[model samples]
Target: MNAPAIDARKWMPYPSAGGAPTTLYCLPHAGAGASTYLPWRKELQPDVDVVPLQPPGREMRMRDEPFENLTPLLNDLLAAMDGVWQEPFALFGHSLGALVAFELARRLSAGEGPRPAHLIVSGRRAPQHPSRLPWIRMADDPMLLEIVRRLGGTPDEILDDEQMRQTVLTLMRADLGVDQTYRYRPDPPLDVPITVLSGSTDSHVTMAELEPWAECGSAGVDIRLVPGGHFFVVTQRETVLRRVRHCLVGSP
Candidate 1:
């Protein structure tokens, strides 16, 4: 059977000059749409095209139910990105999106498509590292609320509203399931270079967890600490953009 179709019309593009040799595909964190990267697109050099992936369950596709697992979601995303691989491309993803970017790189390497020239992961630990917290699959309402409270991304309005809270909480639970249930199988390091970014104050991920990214690729690994907490991308936009531009266009 064929995989389900993803609605690509939801994706928004921040196009660049025609002569650029590379495209940077940015993926959003869980519950986030492509709008997250719309601001960064302008900050990048004119030669770098920024394409943000808009997954189901958000924005224009808010009516569609979110995916309960990563496998199906990734399949849909790869399909949505099908014909847009016109140039040497790189990927930048934050938090949950970082995991998606990593997995997508693995898939592209195994598939017939052009492999990404670089992978930029932000606000997430390496896949090989074990999570420190207990799996949240069995959490009750109070427990889930505590987790969400500590995580600090969900807005207060959503937390207070019954309808919005249910919608977001359901999506969060499924996304956390995908993250917790995942097990990294040993594979040879990727040929493409990897650059990992994390916030200095992110309580969830330790330095040890971030270091293991070096093991994922054979070419080279660069890890940097930025300001702010898990949502540092929002707080440190210019610095993040500078580092990303340097990685993609600068030395190997």
Candidate 2:
């Protein structure tokens, strides 16, 4: 089935200033909108363009229905990003975003396109291992709230507001549904070099769990332990961006 047509540019609200030699396409963690990485442009511009992808049902795409499965979500992304893939680029995704980025990288590697130079994944276990995290797609609303609150990214004000809380939970469930339903199919290892970043104290993903990522990429995988937990992508923003820049541009 053909994925519905979407204005491709809408996915990137903060495009590079057009002077960078390469681009970094970023995918957000579950329940997160692209705005989460908005500050990245300043961190990696001229050298690399930071483009964060905004999935539906979040931020400006709030009214659009979110995809509950990874296949259609990726299909839509592939269709929408047809032109954007022409340039020299890399991918970075955190948590659920990590899985999405990994799958996307595999697709690009197998298909016709300029494959990403690097794949940077954070706070998610390698696909080869079964996810140790709880499957929260079917959890009740209160449970969902607790899970989201425990995850530590969503603002307290949003959770406190009735309408806002509903909106957040709806997006979270749909995104988590994508995670719960995803079944990783074996494929040849990716051609791109991969950098796996894990939080030192991440409650969901341990340092040991990141080891299997080496098998997923033939180009070589570099795994590093940084500070904080699953939400370290935000809490340790500078550290994350620095590592990402190092991976792609060889800076510092």
TM-score, one value per model: 0.90, 0.94
Over 118-205, each residue of candidate 2 has an lDDT whose tens digit, in order, gives 9999889988777554677658999989988987778999999999999999999898888888887878899899999999998888
lDDT of each residue in 1-252, candidate 1, tens digit only:
986664455554443345665789888887677888888766775757788877767766677667766788777777766765756889999988898899889888887467999999999999997555557788976787778778877888888999888777777776676777777888888888999999999998889899899999998999999998999999888888888888878722
> How many steric clashes between backbone atoms does each model show?
0, 0
- What global local distance difference test value does model 1 have? 0.80
Question: Which sections of candidate 2 miss by over 4 Å?
Answer: 1-5
- Please give me the total number of clashing residue pairs in predicted model 2: 0
Colliding pairs, model 1? none
Clashing pairs in 2: none
